[model samples]
Target chain A: MPLRRWSAAAAPLAGSPGTKQIVVARENWRARAQEIAAAGGRLMALWASGPAATGRPAPRTLYAAFVLPPGLLVLTMPDDLAHDEYPGIEEVFPHASRMQRALFDVSGWRSSDPDVRPWLRHAAWPADFHPLIHETAPTAAEEPRPDDYAFVRVEGEGVHEIAVGPVHAGIIEPGHFRFSVVGEKVLKLEERLGYAHKGVERRFTELPILEGHRLAARLCGDSTVTYAWAYCQALEGLAGTPIPARAAWLRALALELERAANHLGDLGALGNDAGFAFGLSQFSLLKEQLLRATHAAFGQRYLLDFVVPGGTRADLAPEGARALSDCAGHLAQQTRVLRGIYDEHAGLRDRFAGAGMVTPALAARLGLTGLVGRASGQAHDLRSDAPWAPYDELAPGKAGATEGDVAARVAVRFDELFESCRLIGRIVRDLPGGTHLAAGLPTPPEGALGIGLIEGWRGPVMIALEAGASGSIRRCHPHDPSWQNWPVLEHAIIGNIVPDFPLINKSFNLAYSGHDL
Target chain B: MWKTLRQIARTGIVTQPPPTGDGSLRLREALQADIREILGRALCIRVVDSGSCNGCELEIQALNNPVYNLEGLGIRFVASPRHADLLLVTGPVARNMDVALRRTWDAMPDPKLVLATGDCAATGGIFGETYATRGRLASVIPVDIVVPGCPPAPERILAGILAAIRASHAHPRSR
Candidate 1:
């Protein structure tokens, strides 16, 4: 079932890091996707780019990127403009359903999928007016019509639908969750996201390719390092520019720091959700310390604009590297001790152990990926699976568990935290000598396609960039792991009690803004 | 239990130079009197993510950390708009969220203040005035103060909240 194994032997797609690309005919698109699905290739992202965004007279094209056992494989098929439709892979990859819907919303192109519910357009703009294709966009000043988007009904005895939000009780991003529950047990869970969509795909065409990293960093704040790095990676690849050795190591350091920081925050939040306030206090303290150290090292708490095209924004100072290394080491020791406290706590263990199980079989079928997938025995980490530069040399340890529960996810987080600390220490200790930014970076020629894929803290964050007329950004797509994982969450919550939804949701912590964008 | 206690004891109290709403409080005695009369010292805020990159939310959530200890100053994030005295919103106003933002503001009990946090909320940041978004939060809702930064620091968020209360106390009808 494994398609030739994901080794670097297969020719890499032009202007991408170890990812293979094949331009398939529209007729064979579905069959090719079926082959990939049968071969256990995970669908990474499915997006469409049209003439309007690309600034070309050519027909609209559909791009499907998959993670085979060996590495990243991207399949592209140009659309038949007469039909405005392309073959849908939803049957093979169930997660592609939402992506196809979003694809139709962004590009004017439709997919062959049966269920054609509007995903991103929630009665805000005219139904006929597609933002990417159409030149003029609505001001959205007038009152929008109430959304008539129907939620699938589950009619049964004592099965009542409980609506949760586009706006929630807490300070998180907006997304509505409709739960059809019988008493406390959830019968079905459906989500209606895309409330945060700001026409970023269309906006990309307007910005210069060089300035796109800033926008990419802002796509999702927590995953800033990955998003920026991925965008720059695409740009760097297109320009045929290899970043300096020191910049590569520094980028990895920032990435690891981000991962460690997020884990600390989530671990604490999980503890708090499980009624352990003390864990929140301690972990939050540690997270703050890490953030402070990060600020000292990288000049930003969250590293919004650190990873620029060609190389990083700034070089690492000796003192800054030392501070970051020291912080990581300190956090590692504290986390090791605290992880033990969590493991031994009977109450905490009970709360986390059996809640919201996504079985390995279910995970594979539904295409659940990233850290959550790792917990469910889908042992895939881009760092180890498709190592690039520092990762190629450093070889990070992959922490996985098959328990497929909140507890398993927590254990993975703990493992990752320790590993990240170790990785950070190594990166700083063996700092390479070179300029942070590349010298005299050349702009990629028009119509050049490049993709940057990275193992972000949340999963494989990708930015597919195609340079436009005169160094302008043509069509750029930023894909978050949330797109694949969010739908799986609905299945994960099934059979679990309603109150435990938050704990399970937080365990994944999928990006809303990035997905919506 | 011993490990938990030991950790807490060792960590001690990290909350230093806790936010003093002093400058704004002393800026206008009338605004102070308005705060005293209409609002209690306890400022209840309801944060709405109109449509943001979630950078601002990170800082807003950090307010709960021990280092900031936002609750220690009697400011707490409430669950409902009905319970809130101020609306601390983040992100640019997405077209889809515009109605929801209006309804949230409408639902809030009057004499409320609006503090737009981060550059996105202030002026729509990077993804500005798009077809899908209405741009800055103020275009949709009247904002008293804007705490700028890509995602402003936790301290700046606190300062914006205080400044919003002070700014709105003078106008009181900005909501």
Candidate 2:
């Protein structure tokens, strides 16, 4: 009944296996978005594709994917370049405001939303110039001007602004945070990102479809394995290539290892933010050892570019599997002890508990996903909800906490670290015997589209790939969960003290480069 | 507290030996000599990410782990560039971050060293000269040392920092 209200035609995704595509009439786009939201579907990603690949004088297509519990539902609507305007669904989905702004800036489509302040266009180029449009390019007449971003002003007695960096004191990726504070209490926190935007989506068009995985892997250094896997899934699906069973299992193994490494690092950093240097030293040591083991197993420390289209670039030797198993066993033991110490430490607990709380209702309203969402009772894990290949077999048990605070996030990370360790152990023990590489993939017909939705360590990392005529990438959009989670950080920081900001932020730890791209 | 202490006692001294050769020894010796001759007994470093993927940042953080013990070498990261002796910069200097990077460079006092880490910062590794990126740290500011890898290892980053310190001492500024 809910599905019949707005969709003109609905069918399963042809090239992409796990999703369904719904074609809505241009006039019914907003109505369909409202129907999806009314049915409690969370907006996973919102992106727009340029008309360059569809020949001259074509309309740009805007796509929005919603997670509808059973599966993913995608809606597509076209925007004519003449009008350059579309119905904004921000009223239905509050998180759609910034996404619409970003889509407008890149594709030159204006949304109906009144908040027209630039999201990604930070005055590096002219206001009229849009990057994703093939016809538009910055000319000599359009010189770079000073970027005076009109940050939302907070006015009152003793209300002042504290601006933190695009270049921070810590060795972190660039993003400016403007906090409207009175004394130490933060009234509002506004983030100005996109400083690390490297035009990744535009670069995807230039690379061969098969080689786009390399660029995807570097989308965010910490989530390399997840991004690479997601990209490969989309590419292989579009090409209708069936990867080897062994390769699928091995990819899961790498993903779990990557998850464990990140969780370890975050646990330690969270401790360090709470003034426990000992935890940082110990956890950092464990993370280093785990990375070394990963390097030995995968031939790359960060597992960068290891997962390519069709299959993986490298195979896991028997000796490497054994080493990985042993390393996982050791890490499990050490992490258990560290978790205990973190739990018992009063100072750490004091700093973590009840800090930067995001209620379950707030999380659902904002469409938060991944680890941050899980911490706040949004128990939507793609691994359990919609499993493909190896995860379907593994059936990873979901881990979640409903407290929605710094402690809850930490608890979720610990649970995930343990779960991922278990996963790695099982994957290596049940390592399949076959070729790791899938060969002879036939390219899909031109204009064919594929979608990949994988439960990355942080959350669901989705990649939508469209194939060009000559085995080239027409367009690719790798959407990070950070896009949905970054705005929620503002709500999380409300009423929290300035000093506690770092600790709360470390718990979420949304990737700046990932979101900026 | 007791548990932490017990764990520390059990894992007594897990500090691995400083890397040898691989150009690390020579750089360390040069740095020690330069510190003794020029500035003092300690070095304060400030880190900046122009537009990196955070891979180089991870490796830089690894330098402070128990294995590397960067603080034992009398080198520490500072919160402000004004108090820093060396600036460890990463990424391929994004177009939007160019002014910020230059301002950070200018904020450092006289007799400051800049060590550009990672291949992106050294030569704009994969994200070459694009409209969004200016490409490489040297294009924006003077780089005394270049540590090149997609993300150079922690040992290599340590060596590069030492080499930059030695170079800074050799060409002391007139301030």
- Each model's TM-score? 0.95, 0.94
Q: Give the alpha carbon lDDT tens digit for every residue of A270-359 in model 1.
A: 998999988888899899999999989877888889898878887889999899989988999999889988988888999999888999
Question: Which stretches in model 2 have alpha-carbon errors above 4 Å?
Answer: A4-8, A14-16, A53-58, A80-82, A139-145, B20-41, B167-175
Worst 10 residues of 2 chain A by lDDT: A136-145
Measured with C-alpha atoms, the lDDT of residue B77 in candidate 1 is 97
Per candidate, native contacts kept equal 0.80, 0.66
- Least lDDT summed over 10 consecutive residues: which range in candidate 1 chain A? A1-10
In candidate 1, list every pair of residues with a backbone clash.
Answer: A6-A70, A6-A71, A165-A176
Report how far off residue A22 is in candidate 1 (Å).
1.3
Candidate 1 stretches with Cα past 4 Å from truth are A1-11, A81-84, B22-33, B165-175
lDDT of 1: 0.85
**What are the lDDT scores of the predictions, listed in order?**
0.85, 0.83
lDDT of 2 by residue, A445-485 (tens): 67878888778889999888888768887778888999999
Candidate 2's displacement at residue A95, Å, is 1.3
Docking class of 1: medium
